[model samples]
Target: MRLISSSISLATAAALLSACATLPQGTSRDSTNTGLDVRTRYVGLTSDAEVAEILASPLGEEAAVRLALFNDHTLRARYDQLAITEADLRATGLLPVSDGARTPEAGIALPVLDIFLIPLRNKQGITIPERIEIEVTDHAVALIADVRRAWTRLAVAKQAHNLAKMSENIARAAEKVAVELADKGNLPADELVARKIAVANAEHAVIMAESERREAREDLAGLLGVDLMGDWFVHNADPATIPADLNAVDMQAVMDNSLALASSKAEVARVGASHGITDISSILPDIDLAVSAERDDHQWEVGPSIEMPVPVFNFDGPKREKAEADVRAAQYEYAHSLVVTANRAALLVRERDAAHKLVKLLNEQVTVAADQAVAASLRQYNAMQTGVFGLLAIRENAVEARRHQLQGWQRYRNAEVAVDAARAGVILPLKN
Candidate 1:
């Protein structure tokens, strides 16, 4: 019977040990979509499909913006940082304390006296979470600023593409004119060659413009958490239509809303002071309950616990200094950012105003040049005294005027984008 019992106990022990030693299988540990790679979806999209979908599909813009929001690796990392800080805050709030031990001894020969003592454990208070919260808030604000910048870039790219298309149309017309003049033996071969070169350059410019537009779309898509390969397009919203009115903004009022700086300063102070003080709490039985136990000859005693850390080696001296320095650094950075933003806004506004003036001047010049070219051409052609050189010169002047007008228009658009960027407190709309 004893041998049978021993065998049963050994078998039970082995089963328990096996259960404890076994680990979960790969399938059990795997998460939803664990084997799939999200990035592959983007890589699978052909360049032509990307461009065609962006230009033709209604979902293009939405997908692009969403990709920027979610798939952009950089933004994803920032989100992860924010999550970590949130977890840290939760951990800080729960402040764990170690349990104390109790031991009992019989009162030997002395029947009238009973003695009991409990060892106390000391715990130092932690205040790093408050500082961490401040840092996280600052990071969040910076991330928002980054998003604004990326969006501005996206907007600028779209405008550039539009301008490039316009330029390409003009270049094609000029090329046709050059070919006709060359066939009539009225223009030199060199002039025809120049026009052909201009056409090629314009075509190249269009290709570059398309590339930039694609990059901007991808950037914005990443920021908005959309698939890069997804069909989407950004609506060509005229950012220039928005007017900048200084009266609409109260600088002082806006400055007052810097909560990150304020919180950081407060946190620094809170953390520094907390480092010098110890947090104390009790987990002892009630005195009345102890007295009740005393009547049963197993007397319980009320124990006082002292929790403290001996500041022999690490007194958090360096840590306090670092915290104070961080507060100052944050203040400085906040101030600097405000100043830089204001300066940039002012500069962009001035640039836009200048570009608008230039555009107006170019428009007037184009009108006057067009009238001159028409009058010159008609007089020379009707009088039958028109030289090839004179006719070609006038036509060339008209073409140059048109080119200048186109350039002015492009500049105006660019300036408008700049002004919008300034007002929006960002340089580009597409998130990098």
Candidate 2:
């Protein structure tokens, strides 16, 4: 009975000890940790009036800028790349191997027999993070360039929309005048039909302009991680004309200013130089304490951990060649981009100069046409030598002259925008 009670007590104690050992290792709650929720609110449906109000509000420009910041798929993808690189950086800091152990015990009454046990552990150094960092830095520079490119495109779209709006207004005025003359029978019915056709054409222009504006807005919104259909307006100052003087710009100098290509070359050279070095370390044996009835024995052992690659079969020959080729390719691309940009700038400058000259000539023509039409109308009206048809014809000529002048101005503005974009390496403001 006493032996049975002792066995039961020992079992109960062992069960309690096992339960304690099986408990979780850490506390469930921590003061510094907080749950994160990434839900975003979308803008509600808005009317034209509401859109106008939103545009007037300060939030509209904020939203526009935010859209530029967030909605870009390229920029967003870069962010993900940055995250992946960061994780790789963390992983690189960790050692490649870790320690582990196991133990076993048994009761026996045999003599002249013994059991042996083995323990194992491993340690190695990691050095790939440094290389990863260099690559990631290069990627960051490229991301900045992408952002600038997207912003320039958005600005261009807005300017185009403004030009289209001005054209629409001119078309509307012409249509109104044509309708009035036709109603009075001073103009042929076909003239009014032509005017209606012009109205339809002008409406189509407006639609196209709106479509472009929406596309730009959506692109910017996507970059910002915002809803593309959100009510927002861009408030920018009127675009400035390109300067008349571009003779001082050296095309060759601009072409040599590529930092990305330079960085890539430098990194490829550095990594190639370090490719042969391998990480190696050694581990000191550990001491274990034990209690025994008579005495205790201690043993020590030493081991080396080597992490060198065997160059007999693979010496990174292929990888080094690839890196050298990449450097050459990057240099070529940088040179090419510079040449293309400079040539485009030169062409745009010439085009702008021609457009300015044309606009000047058209302005003078409009003035002369206006005077001639007015003089003709006054003479006919004073002498009663012409009917309403003659007067209406003179008026229509003046209106047409004005329309031509508007068109010349629009063309000149567009040419100027192109010049500005080329010169500044970015998009210019809209010419309202």
Candidate 3:
């Protein structure tokens, strides 16, 4: 009786889920003991008002990241979806044998052999939680990258547009000079007309550039999940580098944090448990116990009865083979993830370094050349050594050079963001 009671208690304890999962808030932030990626940090907002307040302020790169982490409805919905796993636990429906049979039974939680099965117990206890939390970290990494890249584009657009406006001023000045030369008959009719055409092109370019700037701001705002109509502002154009903490990059860290590997590992646990259940079902006999009390011609009888199913055909063979195959498949999937992650990490590192060098080269050399070009052109025009068109061309080239230089800086910053996300910290490695 004590043994049966203990078994009943065990089964009940394993299968109840009263609430859904949520992001850890407050002081428990990023607690690594749960097997989730340690680098994922989030702050949950209590209401739409808090999000509004953040949006009201000048949103910096880091602030934008924080808002997206907590404010995005799609992300929150994904976190809530983990609760669906609880439904699977409930599907057994307490297994209460309410029909009046010889065996009168009542138990805690419920007594279902499958729930109490060794394999299922292990999966419910460990693997499911690990898999869900892997997704938490995965989503966070992707969202943060989005914030960084969008913020960079917004900043670059504003800078580029301002640069374009400055170029227009130079074009306008060239047009004025052409007007003066034409009045004196020193400049040809075609040359003055060409100067007017140059001014017109520069003005059109500024308008297009401004339109792009607004669109970039809108995109950045949308990612932040602020009110669509609210005014947008950026606190930092350049995203700060997320420094790596490890003395050396460890592949193990990424593997531990990979969602894909976590899913496969969970599958392995589930199948291994299924394999155990099948093996037990084939080998062990099912014992049915019943007790009854009755008055038959003033005679009372109450005793326990036992019945078993004979093992005619062993059922574990095909199931065992299938479980073995599943295990092999999961192992191969894990191996593939590792290889892909390593290759990705190497590629991001190379591109980041190259991008950094390219941006530096543009800043150090191109800007200087552009300045000299403008100065020499101005000197030549004043000395009448070059025509108005020649002077305008030099100035136009300088402005275009500046535009490319700004774009190069934006690309370098974006590359750094990619590398940072790809690194995912040693605490949260890209899972192989």
Best by TM-score: 3
1 against 3, candidate with superior TM-score: 3
Q: Supply candidate 1's per-residue lDDT for 343.
A: 49
Q: Rank the candidates by lDDT, best first.
A: 3, 1, 2
**Model 3 per-residue lDDT tens digits across residues 126-156:** 2234445445445655666777788888877
Of the pair 2 and 3, which is ahead by TM-score? 3
lDDT of 1 by residue, 70-147 (tens): 234553343344334433444455433223211111111111100001000010122224433333333323333444
Ten contiguous residues minimizing lDDT sum, candidate 2: 112-121
The best candidate in terms of lDDT: 3
Q: Give a tens-digit lDDT track for model 2, residues 1-432.
A: 011000001010011111111111122222112211100001221234543454455343334433332233543344344334433444454423223211011111111011000000010012223333334323322323333334444555566566566556656676787778878887788878877786688679778867866776666555544555655545442223333443444433222222232333334334434543222111111111112123226543332111222222233578756644544443344334433454555665666667667666656666577768778887978899876545655665665565455445555555555443332222133232
Q: What TM-score does candidate 3 reach? A: 0.61
Evaluate model 2: give its TM-score: 0.40
lDDT of 2: 0.40
Superposing every Cα of model 1 onto the true structure, what RMSD results?
A: 24.9
Residue 69 in model 3: lDDT: 58
lDDT of 1: 0.42
